[model samples]
Target chain A: MSIKDCLGIQDEELVKKSLENIDYFACIYERYEKKLIRYILRISSFSYHEAEEVLQEAFVRVWRNLNEFDESLKFSSWVYRIVHNTTITEWRKTQSKGKDRKQDIDDELYKNLPSNLNIEKELGRKIDADGIKRVLDLMPEKYRSVLILKFLEEKDYNEISDILKKPTGTVGTLINRAKKSFNQIADKENITFTV
Target chain B: MENSQKLLDKIQKENIEQRKKSEFAAKNIFFWTMFTLSVLIGGLATSVLIFAFGQTEFDLLSHITHSRVELFLGMLPIVWIFFSFVFLAASIALLRKTKKGYKYSPVLVLMGNLIMSLILGTVIYFSGGAVKIESIFAKNVPGYQSVEEKKTAIWSAPEDGFLSGTIISVENEVILQDWNGKDWKIDTKDALIRGRVSMRIGEEVKIIGEMSSEGLFKASEIRPWKGQGNGANHVNN
Candidate 1:
């Protein structure tokens, strides 16, 4: 089928086709590749190259475990879960190797953050994207990941819970705590907002 | 698009196969089975614990020299309690590993397991399954003492005003052989028999009375060996 036809097909249906023929798997891969890579970059200190590597590995795992995926869950959530785990595992391996990893937030991605985050109302000033990135870098990994999933990815609590393998209540709590932590870190850093 | 093409080419180059659906199904079934078994075993432990507490004669602590606190502490079935908690933890861990198990909060999961075990335990206890299981364990398992055995041991102290034995004869003075095979002459003229206790020959009885002399015990009250008799009828002599 053409790309237009594939675009119209749902992810769950695509998974069945992908399982039968490897060529159909390309459609699933193309659908999630960019989003998954952006998610990896947001949640970790991975470079574009490293994020691409992680996404590739994660998609391969998704292919191998296609039959294991539960139909009840949104296919995107399952893919995100695999990508999240893969990113974390890869990050841990790099840390163990004593690699000096640095946070690399894309300027384009950061520019979109303020619109999604209602922080301007609370701060009474327009906080810049760099300040948000700095505060996210300063925050703990658990809190940072939750914030990235909530604000950056625009995922709801149930979706976040599915991806993180946490209860919906715990996901809500984590997101609240993450936002609070972010404000506290921003305050500590004394980030000057452009009014 | 280029990366996707490259990955697709790599997939074609390498013979990577999707894992069978049956494999995931087996894993899910295994986790669910283990979780259910853990809860069931936990319930059994709880039932046995209830039975142990039920058979404990807390009211008879007044007759013994030891304090009530000491007797109560000594009577606690630590092994059964430990088993119950172990099974509970196992069930919780196994459940968390299952699909959608992480959807529940830890407190909710813990309470759910505990309440389920309690409900199952109460049913088992009321159905008399616990007693039968305890009896089997006591007779067959080495060093394993049933609640009845523990009760018998607690009541076997003659000097402390507690004695239990099988009645050899019911005469003017009863001849009773204690658990240790030693015979005792019990004076029952002023004794008050509690519950529906039969003073017939070969009947096991628990007496709350002091040792008057060697091999002789003065009985203040007599009760059946099984339990603190539910019957309030006091046969006074």
Candidate 2:
């Protein structure tokens, strides 16, 4: 049976098994590849190729540093942190090269956002996907990252803090600021939902 | 999907190495060691500055006998205090860089640095290293004399002035090494000697006196200087 076929196995348990048999590590790569690609794409505005390169580097780092992973943290959070750092480093290098990637909002990510989240309601109206994308791109990186992690990735404050390497209170503050900025931007742009 | 498979195959082909737990622990140990050393050095620096302040001849109570606020403000050790704050900031920055530093809030980390400095300061005080370090700074660091000189000028004023110094000699009169290391001849014939009134060479004494034209200090009273707060009542000139 494929490792993916093994249901109910926690990521932590997978890490322990992968420590003994390196081949089992492929399971971790398989599980997180798409999610990480999406996250890196959204955060760094990387094209799929650039995102793939970052993903490969991030997985390599995780594989080499597996033993250094603290069991106290969720394995997913730890993996995402490595990916986050690697992507930011890649993003900086890309910036230095004066290459800009169109920050095309992934339809899957946009669709996956919870319908009940206030990003739409707070505008006192609904914004189309293009309006939402424009508002997100206009905001500062700090606020944009928090909004993506909160609404897009659906991470709670603690997990967001772990991934961002910030305190939970700081994460809360960033979310509040992001929401306010989003409301103002949407209002300024006059986004209205069509039936 | 094929690309994901290739990445997995790459991991298997490379035989990626897992970092040793000892190495992880070593990194943590190294960060903590640097943090602790920073705090200790910062604390010792703070204690040294405090000791220099303590060794000053500016008697707060006596200076208050003039204009309280001006004297207090003038005698404030602004330079040493600035140094203390700089050391504190360095310690806090090091603490934040530690591996588990982010686990504590910034305020908690700052308070931790302060408490560490306080504890280390007390230890340095008891070990008598504070005074030694203070003297070293005074001699070696530039502008060290400026703060001290201002304090001595305020303390050694000529009229109704107060001075505390080590008695260099005591024959018919007392020769003192004053706070600024200058010699002062005190005429104690008309003075009231208080507080276990025994005179000896090398003992510290506080004298309240008038400055004669001959540049000798005519004492109205002399009291044994029993460190701080012991001879406040003796300033009777």
Interface RMSD of each: 0.9, 1.8
Give the Å shift of residue A20 in candidate 1: 2.2
CA shift at B28, candidate 1, in angstroms? 1.4
| Every model's DockQ | 0.74, 0.50
DockQ of 1: 0.74
Model 2 residue B131 lDDT?
Answer: 69
TM-score of chain B of 2: 0.64
lDDT for each residue of candidate 1 in A1-195, tens digit (9 for 90 to 100): 335558788999999998887777888888888888888887777888989989888888898899998989999999999999999999989989997556655677678666767656543457777877777778898998988887778788889999999999999888778877877887788976652
Tell me which residue pairs clash in candidate 2. Answer: none
- By DockQ, the best candidate is 1
How does each model score on lDDT? 0.85, 0.73
- The most accurate candidate by lDDT is 1
Question: Which candidate has the top score in TM-score?
Answer: 1
Runs in model 2 with CA error above 4 Å?
A1-6, A112-127, A184-195, B12-16, B56-87, B127-129, B132-203, B206-226, B229-237
Instruction: Write out the backbone clash pairs for model 1.
Output: none
Expressed as tens digits, the lDDT of each residue in B93-158 for candidate 2 is 765666556556677778878888878887897799886776777789886755446645555665
